[model samples]
Target: MTPEQVLVAPGRRHVYWHSALTVVVLVGAACLAHRHWPVLERGAVRLAVADQGWLLVGGTAAAATWICAALAQQGAVVRRLPQGRLVAAQFAACAANHLLPAGLGAGAVNLRFLMRCGLPAGRAASALAVKGAAAVVVRAALIVVLALACPGVLRFPRLSAGILAAGAVVVVCLAVVPAWSRCRRALAAVVADFRAVHANPSRAAALWGGSLVFAVLHALVLIAVGQAVALPLSPARVALLYLAASSAAALLPTPGGLGSLDAALALALTASGAPGAAAASAVLGYRLLTVWLPLVPGLVVLTVLIRSKAL
Candidate 1:
């Protein structure tokens, strides 16, 4: 095989391997949790859902956030994604993230969608990579914002190391080699693409709008989770906890950051004044609401996109 073919071959193989391992690991985790799984399930079923009114409020907020995030994602693509298609693509990503372990399936589906749009695969890859990096920046900002906004975080010493390590890493990634040049030379050649997609105020508005809304809804999710666990933490604490835990989960290799999401959330909450069990329960519940809730829509979107040959 040619050199380009060699690079392509390994990536293809890795994708397949990651996808396969994700399925295997999920099954294994489930089987291992068999006995305690029931207890955990039962315990989780007893989780207190906020009042119907609040649930409606929460659900609406969440749905809106998803829509906004969809718009932001669409804004990233130079050739704009149709409203329906954009929403569908995001839902597919979300679905893949939850059901698939490796979390790259979302990127995989997205890359294919872009390719079908006549955009090269490299550009598609870069757009997603940029978003990934943006997420990292957002994460750091969240922590810093929380620390400055919520002085209460210093009360818990347990989270000190994790938070510090995270801040340090974020600084390095953004400050050091952005890696964008090395990542997408071919895509970078399309100079007008970014201008076409991002020059207008509307696109920036959409992205900032979505990102801010995402943060708000995320805090609300944490509040709902805190309520479920009887944690009584403030919104500020929850926000910081959310960022910190998610950042840690991003470091994990597990599909969708499953185990790590829960574990990190638990630790962060505990450090933020929540009891371990309750924090665990809250994290579990939030995952149910935030992660699994959009899954059905995602699957539907993916199926529709595939039928339309978008992927």
Candidate 2:
């Protein structure tokens, strides 16, 4: 390349990488590693759980959400695979995500599974992409609901500035969404074929309803975790904090989003007036509930698949 071209390319590449690193660092600092221990005491855990029964309810709902998410994607290409198989594929995809790092394991697993099941790559990719988008929209909706439902929670003086800035940036990004060439095309295409997707109202409803339920399950677990550590916090407040912690972890590509979620949850709770140590302990317990809980079921499903020579 010419000297001028090299100089310009270097600057752009450096900027791109810097921005990427910044986001990862910011998320990590905000979301990973529950460093507080004072809040996570054994006695607190025993008493906290005894006070509420939401955790069990939330777990059941989360499992159901995964099933629904799988079915939703399957409904996209009804002719290629049976409903039951599609749902199984969903569990396998999630299982792979937990087993592998940086999101690679899940994608490869899904791709191979789809190919083995006789689906064209395009169809499989499209279906998964659609389901993923539905998840994001559902998450955003959940955040908005929590924010509105608990005004006291949203009115955090310390996080107030950051919240405003983030909200503004999100708003600007969404406003420019139409200008993204591929996004525009995709939107146009989906709009064109909306009738068919809506033809089976039951499937569409399941997908959306499943989306909301999945988000609520997220809220409930965090609230339970907080309670388990003896936090006197309101469930609504807990929901908002969980929203921030989960969002921060999602921004990171870390395996299990482990440290990030722990850190974020503990810090958020501490910032809200809980002792740091107690918050940290709760976060650890919370991570076990949110991350490892799904992993067990995922592994069991994988064992069944392998034994059947499905993998």
Estimated TM-score for each candidate: 0.74, 0.68
What are the root-mean-square deviations of the candidates from the true structure over C-alphas?
5.7, 7.6
> Ten residues in a row with the worst lDDT in model 1?
1-10
Best-matching candidate per TM-score: 1
Q: State how far residue 264 of model 1 sits from its true place (Å).
A: 0.8
Q: Tens digits of per-residue lDDT for model 1 on 168-275?
A: 998778556756554345345344445555677777566555666676787687676566556667767887778777776776556677766666776688776775
Supply every candidate's count of residue pairs whose N, Cα or C atoms clash at under 3 angstroms. Answer: 3, 16
lDDT of every predicted structure (CA atoms): 0.65, 0.61
Task: State which candidate has the highest lDDT.
Answer: 1
For model 2, what is the alpha-carbon lDDT of residue 262?
61
Instruction: Give the CA lDDT, 0 to 100, for residue 279 in model 2.
Output: 67
